[model samples]
Target: MTNNLSVVINSDAQQVWTMLREPARIAQWHGWNADDQEAEINEIYFGPNVVEGADHTSLVVDGGDVFTLKPVPTGTEVSVTRAAIDHNSEWAAWDEDITQGWLTFLHQLRFALERHPHGKRRTFFFSVPGTGGSAIENLGLSDVPAPGDPYSLTLPTGEEISGKVWFRSNHQVGLTVHNYAEHGEGLLIVADQPAIADVRPDGGSLAIVSTYDLGAHQLDAIRNYWDKWRAENYPTSDPVH
Candidate 1:
């Protein structure tokens, strides 16, 4: 089955098109990459069958995923269309996940273009068990949000951030982290990672994809805080991750 997602970015089509073709820019906005499995980005866009256009890029993967940019009066209309899935193939099992993954990346493209145009990001990653009962509650988020509502959260580390909710699902929450001053904003994704059972002790990963250079000390401080919080909240039975 095919699936697609679209967003109107507040930038010109040429600018957005440039970001799509550049590997470094793609890393800033998309989740799936060809490497770095520890995080969501894996460099999948650089595949050989890729076709680049004035405002589009068509790639053949899991069938074919076409990325296009249409010029609008305001900016550009960006979309990713996933071709029909071949059920007999190995990619069949990953159909839904790939669709959702593209959705996440498309929104990320809009977020990066609209919010942090020329900013760079430093990503922090960690995982915890999925059996926790009060972890989401303890994070000071009373509930998940739809596409356009305000969401304010206070992390277990006592860092507070407030911004409009980007997207949320039963197993994931994506929110704009708006506390970076002039440096750059952030997209904080808290999601379950059931597919990666081989990595951690059956849990999910927290991705703080931010567009600021919060330095090593500050970054490590937050990472340590999250690790400590995870240790206290999710005592894993296995010694993985």
Candidate 2:
């Protein structure tokens, strides 16, 4: 019915409060589908077009709940004591979703406090054939970053995901794997000829990818192909990554 979430943000309460007041900043790490619409006044692309870290200047992460933040000598105390009817109802399907959402948001807050400029993260999910066709459900690596460690990624824009990836060989495809970290909103890693080719992020490029609507059998294959390269070139040395 109600949940209480709080964290000791590395930055002062004033900085955290400033970020919360910004609709766009809220959306980068916590907005739902509300930030997809191309608003009239705000004119921010929202709703399905909602990318986690695209631009929080407007809004995207309005979870039907209103948050109240207070300052503490140590850091800040953010409380979510009240929310919309939908968030309070038993029909809430994403109880766990909120958990993930809050953790991500706090991470972003911490990042902004530590670094001069704030960063964001977006994570994508998809599946591939374990043996041939049975996709591995929840390998537990969907929301991670480090490889072989059940990793996930986020970009400066938003999150990207593909639950079922069709397996294939030798194909040229431009895709992006959303990475999650303190650097920025999301890391738009292109899915080009070289899957997981360690491609550099072209921040100037206007191209974007959304994590919710992506699907492909070749998705996992691409990751696998990337894994192969990693195995060959960046072999494990001390199992520390």
Candidate 2 residue-wise lDDT, 16-99, digit = tens: 656765655654434322334215213332334333433322223344343445567876665543244465665354453344
Which lDDT tens digits does candidate 1 get at residues 1-241?
Answer: 3334777888987788777767678777766322464233223555555555632534333246787777888888878877777879876766666776776677778887887777776665554555674344556554867767887767776677788887766555678876643464577766554443344444444444453657677766655666676767777622112
Top lDDT: which candidate number?
1
Candidate 2 residue 128 C-alpha distance from true site, Å: 9.9
Question: For model 2, how many clashes?
Answer: 51
Model 2 off-target regions past 4 Å?
A: 1-4, 31-64, 82-91, 116-241
Looking at model 1, residue 215 earns an lDDT score of: 69
RMSD in Å for model 2: 15.4
Please list all clashing residue pairs in model 1, or write none if there are none.
32-42, 33-41, 33-42, 33-43, 34-42, 34-43, 34-44, 35-42
| Candidate 2 lDDT score at position 166 | 14
Q: After best superposition, candidate 1 residue 130: deviation in angstroms?
A: 3.3
Could you say which candidate leads in TM-score?
1
